[model samples]
Every structure is written in C-alpha cells, then in structure tokens.
Target: MRMNFGHLRGVHVRVFVPSSPYFPAYAQGQGPPPMVQERFQSVISQLFQYRIIRCGGAVDDDMANIIVAQLLYLDAVDPNKDIVMYVNSPGGSVTAGMAIFDTMRHIRPDVSTVCVGLAASMGAFLLSAGTKGKRYSLPNSRIMIHQPLGGAQGGQTDIDIQANEMLHHKANLNGYLSYHTGQSLEKINQDTDRDFFMSAKEAKEYGLIDGVIMNPLKALQPLAAAAEGKDQGSV
Candidate 1:
C-alpha cells in the first residue's frame, strides 16, 4: 500500500512486507498479512512527519545513501523545519561518512545531531559537523576521534598507493575536525593519532558539541514553548 503523510505530500512511501519463509502459512501462499504491512507503513509515515533520521551501527555506503536521500527529501518537503539526527555508530568508511556530512551541509534545512550513545571515529566527525550551536550529546554518551584505519595486502606499489590515499584522508579529516571544533590542526592531529575518547561533558569543553543534554525535557522546552506560542497566536 502507498502511504502519504501530510507534511510529506507527493512522497509516496510503499510498504513491502515479505512473507516469512519459515512460516507454515507462507508455504501455503498466505503471505505478508495485511496487519504487518499496515504497521510498517504507519511507522514510516510517522518518521516522515517527524523528520527524524537515525544513524546506528557502522557508516557504510548503504547507510550513507539512505541518510543523504532523507536529508534531501526532507529539505525539499520543508526547508524551514529543522531535521533531527540521532547518531549512535562505531564509524566506518571515511568516504561514506563524508557523503553524509557533505549532504548534511548542502541541504537547506538545519540538521541537529544528537549523540544518544557512542559516536566514534567518523561517527564523532559527523556529530561535530552538525550545524554549529545545535550539536548535542546525552549526558552518558561517549565520543571518540581518531585517524582513518586501513590495511593493504597487495603488491608493494599497491600498498604504497593505499598508504598515500589513507594519508590524504587523514589530513582532510583533521582539517574538518579543526574547522568544526575550533582546535588547531596540530592539536587535532595529535589527539587523533590514537583512539582519543571523551565523555559528553569533555566533548562539550573540547568544542565537539554545543552542550551535554542532561535533561531532555528542559532541552526541549524552547521548542515546546515556541509551538505553544504559535498555537495561541493562531487562535
């Protein structure tokens, strides 16, 4: 079935729930029951309405593709609205992470990144790259930054090429971190040489995030108040 949310008009979300192969009912061709499809569609519609994107697990090409699409689509739907991204990732694939980062900046809507748990390596980079003054982390979340990790198992020439590419990526990433965190290039390079971890408060002091979210309700009060004010004005 096609699901369309009011905020996400013109965006047709198709819910496809494949029948479980192991289920005996499926073997008889009684497939993905209507209830399952409705549930999936409902969740998708809600996510569209809320404009919430989640980045969990490793940052790979597939994950990056989805995020980029979501960011672009949401911006097209409503650029005035802010997009909230919840990041809890171990980090992987520098290219993939860069894709998401660039798209986050390229879009018209402001992207607010929240570190719900651990944001390590490229994950930390993306967390820091969010719109300035909007990056946040939960009180107990952990953030880590380090150089890109890679290995080569080929001929000497191939290994040399791979090494040079890794160095290039490391330099670019260091520059990005310096720009985002207002830290010196030398300091960023030094801290990222190894696995440098920080608590949420430490990350805020280090300039990786604007604030540590100690109380979620308090943090959201401004938005709530703004909405209430708008409602009152409309009335």
Candidate 2:
C-alpha cells in the first residue's frame, strides 16, 4: 500500500536481504552445529508464534523492511491477530521511520507498540503512531522527540536545499504528532523544538502513550481479546 506523508516529498525506499533458492551451507552441515541451528530456529519460531517484532537497533532501511514484512505476514496469516512491536533505539533515518510509522497505521491487524528501552526521535514517532489506545511503554522506558538534523556538503546551493528539506520534514513530523497525540501543532512544535525527553508516565501525560505498562499479562489482555474477536468474525 502507498503511504501518505502530506506535503513532504516522496522518496522511494527499498529493503534488501540476500537470499538464495538453494539451502545455505549452514543447512548443509558446513556452518554451525545442528543443535545451534535448532536453537536459532526455535527462537525465530517463537517470534512468529507470539506475533512480536523487535526493533532494537537504530532504525534504518533493513529494520523498516523487516517490520513491514512481519506486519504484512501476520495480517496475511491471521488478519485479526495483534502484532506487538518492542522498540529500543536512538532512532535513525527519518525516511525509514516514516515507512514503519505509516505501515503501522495502514495495517488491518491491531498493532501494540511497547517501548522497552529508549524511543528517541524517529523511535518516538513510531511509538506514538501505534494503535492509539494500544500504545505503551515500560516503567523505565524513555521517550523523546526533537527537530530533524542535517548537514550539507558541496556549495551554498546544496546547503540551502538541505535546509529547506529539513524545514518541510519538521512540519510533516509536527502534523504527524498532532494527528496521533491529539496535541495541537503549536504545542507539538514547542515541545519538539528541543531534545524533549519524558519518562513513561510523563509520556502518557503528554499524550504519547496510553499508559505505562506495569504487568505485561494484564496489560495485554484487552488487545488479545480484540484480536480474537476479529479472528472469530473472519472465521
């Protein structure tokens, strides 16, 4: 599905993963031990079983692709299921985050985003873009939003172009914040002008998350039920 970033220039992003039709050496007994491979497979299986995707490192094209694929795969397998995304990153590549942020809103299955560590900049954007009431953060998680950064080389013309791009990008980001957090443009602009940081509770107060997660099982119950309800309806 196409994404809408409103007034921001559209940039095509691609996610690349090296793959082959034939089995790898690992599967052919030339790599890790079978036991190790089994453990690796088991861990991967658990991710799909729980329908959870982790975005722990800096956000980039690869992470964005993986997330979109996971979300799409989950929806295809069971459209009514919930996809839990745990984010812990300093955030990177605004374009990359925008891809995931837009996909989170476009997907059919409900998405619950949990901040396990730090969700700064683009990470903060993704956290707030979660399925509204399903947005969450751990007790100790930190959330932040700030203006975009840029540096230009070449000549003055190149520098001017980069500066203009940052301005438009900031405006688009502000609009995104207003749409998701129910905050006005003025307030979002004021807060994001600096390196704004907040604790989980403070984030909730700022309308970034619905609540701070205290008990995982209890906190996820409603989301689970909602997914099941969708499943039953589809069936």
Candidate 3:
C-alpha cells in the first residue's frame, strides 16, 4: 500500500521511505554496502512512525540554505499535500531559524510538529511554525524557549551590531509565536526574555503545544496517519 503523508502549504507531502523501491535505485553508497542496505532500512524503519526529521544544533547559514532548498523541493513535488515536521534540536542560528519560520508559514501546509527530545531556542520557533495541531514530548522530552543570543567580539561597535541583529530576530520570533500560539506578543516576549523549557504537560496547558504524545519518535508518522484518517472520516 502506498502511504501518502497528505499536504502542507499547497504542497502535497512526500516521504522518502527507506522501504520503497526508490531506495535501491537512488541510495548509492558508500551510502550502502552489501547487507548494509537491509540494516540501514531496518534502523530507519524503526524511526518511520514519525515524520521525525532532524535539524542542526543551532541556526546557521547552512540550515537556512536547507530550509529554502527543501521548501522549493516540496513545492515542486506536490502542491496539495499537508506536511508534518518532526523536530529535535538545542536550536542554532536565529537568522537561519527565522528564515525557516518564514518559509514554513508562507507555504500553507496543514502542518503539525512534534518534539521528541530537545526543541530549544529557535527550534521552538520551528515547532510553532506548524500550521496547527502541534504536539510535543511527554516524558523526558523538552521544549525550550528564550531570547536569541549572539556572538560578539571587539567592543562597543560589535555590541551595537549584535544588539541590532537581535532586535530583528526578536521581532520575527515573536510574530511567529503570537500567530500560532495565540499568546500576546508581550507575553511571549516576557516568557522568552529568559530561557524557558517546558514539560509536555506545561506546554499543553499554555497552548505551546496542542497535546502530549508519549514516545514521540516512535509514533510520529503513525499518529499523523491516524489523525489524517480521522479527519477524513469526520469530513
């Protein structure tokens, strides 16, 4: 059976399932050697329940570049599918993460995001960028939110430059958070002024997440599929 992940942002979602026929043809290696392919598929299959995809430790130009590229690819591939994004990261570049947030918002996916382990800092922004029905960690998983930080050298001049850039990030971050979580901009600003990590229960209570899922990594796609099916039934 073919499993469709549905659509996001006018783009129909697609998954490069390890168990598919495309794997053998496109997976060239060094990417795989002998029985390595089977083992690799097994491992990836274990993770397959989720739309769980990883992001870099912090936002960087590289990750920004990826968000753009992936957006384009998703656009080109399908325009009527909803996309589910699975995230776990300590967070990285603010500029990069902002770009990611913009990219996600522009495309109007029936987006849903889940945090399995660490969705901290800018990563939290990405999590909220989801279209709706956001979910998060239950047990040991965490979600951290705080003001953007920057690296500065030299003296006053560097500090000024960094501060200006930080203001820009804060504006963008708060805008995204306000729209998705329906919290006031001032409240988000206050919450993020200091780094805050939320437990699943706390996140749900504050509307940072829609619900809490146990063992998120293992249930990513399956839950999405189930939800999709449920939505279809209701329709």
Per-model C-alpha lDDT, please?
0.75, 0.73, 0.61
Assess every candidate by TM-score. 0.77, 0.77, 0.69
Lowest lDDT sum, 10 consecutive residues, model 2, at 1-10
Model 1 worst lDDT window (10 residues): 1-10
Q: Using lDDT as the measure, name the better of candidate 1 and candidate 3.
A: 1
- lDDT for 94 in candidate 1 is 87
Superposition error at 66 for model 3 (Å): 2.8
Q: Please provide, for model 3 over 1-235, each residue's C-alpha lDDT reduced to its tens digit, 9 standing for 90 to 100.
A: 1111111123555533233221343434435466876886676455433333345344556656755666655555665565556676667666567677777767644556666677787777787677566444445667878876655566898778866776776787777788778889999999988777687677766667776664335454533553543332111
Question: Which prediction has more favorable lDDT, 2 or 3?
Answer: 2
- Tell me which of candidates 2 and 3 scores higher on TM-score: 2
Give residue 117's lDDT in candidate 1 (0 to 100): 85
Better of 1 and 2 by lDDT: 1
Candidate 1 colliding pairs: none
Q: Show model 3 residue runs off by greater than 4 Å.
A: 1-52, 134-139, 215-218, 226-235
User: Per-residue alpha-carbon lDDT of model 1 for 75-142, expressed as tens digits?
Assistant: 99999888877788878778888999999989998888788888998889999998887788888899
Residue 131 lDDT (model 2): 85
